[model samples]
Target: MIKTRFTEMLGIKHPIMLAGMNWITTPKLVASVCNAGGLGIFASAAYSPEETRKHIREIRKLTNKPFGINQILIGPGAKENIDVAIEEKVPIINYSLGKPWFIDQVHAYGGKVMGTIAIARHAVRAAQLGCDMLAVTGHEAAAHGDVATSMVLIPLVASQVKIPLIAAGGFYDGRGLAAALVLGADAISMGTRFILTQESLVHDNFKQLCLMATEQDTLYSDVFDGMPGRALKSPGAEAMMKKGFSLLQSVKSALEVKRMLNLPLWKFIGLSWSMLKSKEGKGLLIQARSATGAISHLKAINEGDEKEGFLFAGQSVGGIHDIPTCKEVVERIVDEAEKRLKAVGKNVSA
Candidate 1:
């Protein structure tokens, strides 16, 4: 029953949100979260525009509750995906990696745009761009994250932005949600926590490893995709780190990703060229590093290749001990947060 600006704005009963994890957060999982009175976001970055539309419709079929779509603004077909979301009038459009070009278009349809940022300064810029909300990611997050931990970055961005903030990275339970609220976030977004859930499509081996992990079991490195990202320690990930790069693997993975997204060869080449010309895409080294992680992820998540594959995880891996249903996860978080808040109220009064 906890209500914040985020919950009210989205008309949801709780402030918990499932991070739009590529390949992991499917329509079934999204619908489960939405039906459980929390926000469920589908990762649209890995799919083609037609696939994105189909998933969106699938989510609609599963639940009448509000949901969202997350698109990586720097990747191939990013523009096409954005257009698909706009045309479908998706309730919430979440963008990461770059500035959104269609904020006004989203607003025109009464939709909200949420910008995900890891750096404190980016929050200010995203707010300036008319983002309705912000998902501030901390270094403790799985996958790609900035160096600032949630403790410092959440409040830092909160001070500078007027929009409601959704704190991400290292959040796992009700205690984390309560802590995020205290840190000035209106809500919290979790990726790894949701990945270990029953609804998640990740392989059982991956889930078991996370349950067995401690904070030290994860490493943050650029080996996976040449950019700094946090992933579980594995032979494959370790190899990437030692070698300092993965040229052949990256090429193969890039082709796989291209095929998965149904991106034509010309479009793929054009996308690569465009990225190379952009400020973020300056060097070929960055490109090489960035290209290797996707297929490894697919190997681990879809094929159960734990030894030669990468599993992006958060530092919260230390705190998670079991695989629960989405409903259980959300309910436990809400109940714990309520109790903690009440206890704090009493302590303050005393």
Candidate 2:
């Protein structure tokens, strides 16, 4: 097996991770990854606190291996959901978008906190904040990513931080895994690649679309979720880009979010105000757009509504063409990485 600090730190057999894709990384998918020897991160941002607890228990029933939950710290229910995870003594808690104040709480229970960062400077800040590890996202990633690609971002962050680094974005196969290690990452996180697996719950229609996509088939824009992100070039995605921000749609979408989370009107308002005042200071418009994006994301995953829905995808979609089992994907990547590494060693000697 191709072991690295990521594998040793997490007590997993492989230095691979299932990137947390909101709504896509369900209990089953997470468990499957853990069982396959890679770290699976349950996406807690899509569910309420109660739902989060239920799913955490469900994953436990499915696998005894170490696993994690990924939370977007700037949103509502983030604190509540994270509280539930800590109460359950989860193995790892991964967060993004904002600072993690509960690092000590997690570490108190012997759980590790992984910070996800898109910027090189943010990697340094996260390391300083006691993050046990960092998931460095590049611009080629699915969902939210900033300006730098993995090529520039990985080595840059590696030079700045001493903690284990998980390279995310544009990674698909063994070659990519080998390259990530060579670039100084401890492991590689794959979202788009895992989404094509048989264990994934993504609609077959969207899977087919991903198979047909080229590296150029993605569009990056703020319209996807009011924050800059990358998504597959679809009719819904294109329409959103043309339509721009819509206040009316955002209000309607925010209401849907409130109902989905089972939050009372006052509580929902409080959360909204808190988000605005948070360190990120995303404001109401961004939250509203995020609501709209969440609904569309559900449509794409649950109903496969291509015209009205869009799925976040990375440039690596072009390299994925088959729907293999999670175990097969993991094993294949490890085998390929080993061979590639040996080949590189031979070349150096030659």
lDDT of 1 by residue, 1-350 (tens): 89999999999999999999888889999999999999999998878899899999999999999899998887688899999989989999999887789999999999999999999888999999899999999999998899999999999998999999999999999999999999999999999999999999999988888899998899998777777899987776787678777567677767877777788888888888888877755544555455567777888899878777888999999999999999999999999999999899888953
Q: Find the candidate with the highest TM-score and give its number.
A: 2
Tens digit per residue, CA lDDT, model 2, 68-146: 9999998778899999999999999999998899999999999999999999999999999999999999999998889
lDDT of each: 0.89, 0.93
If scored against the real structure, what TM-score would every candidate get? 0.97, 0.99
Q: To one decimal, what is the Cα RMSD in angstroms of model 2 from the true structure? A: 0.9
Task: Give candidate 2 regions above 4 Å deviation.
Answer: none
Worst ten in a row by lDDT for model 1: 280-289
The superposed Cα distance between candidate 2 and the true structure at residue 116, in angstroms, equals 0.3
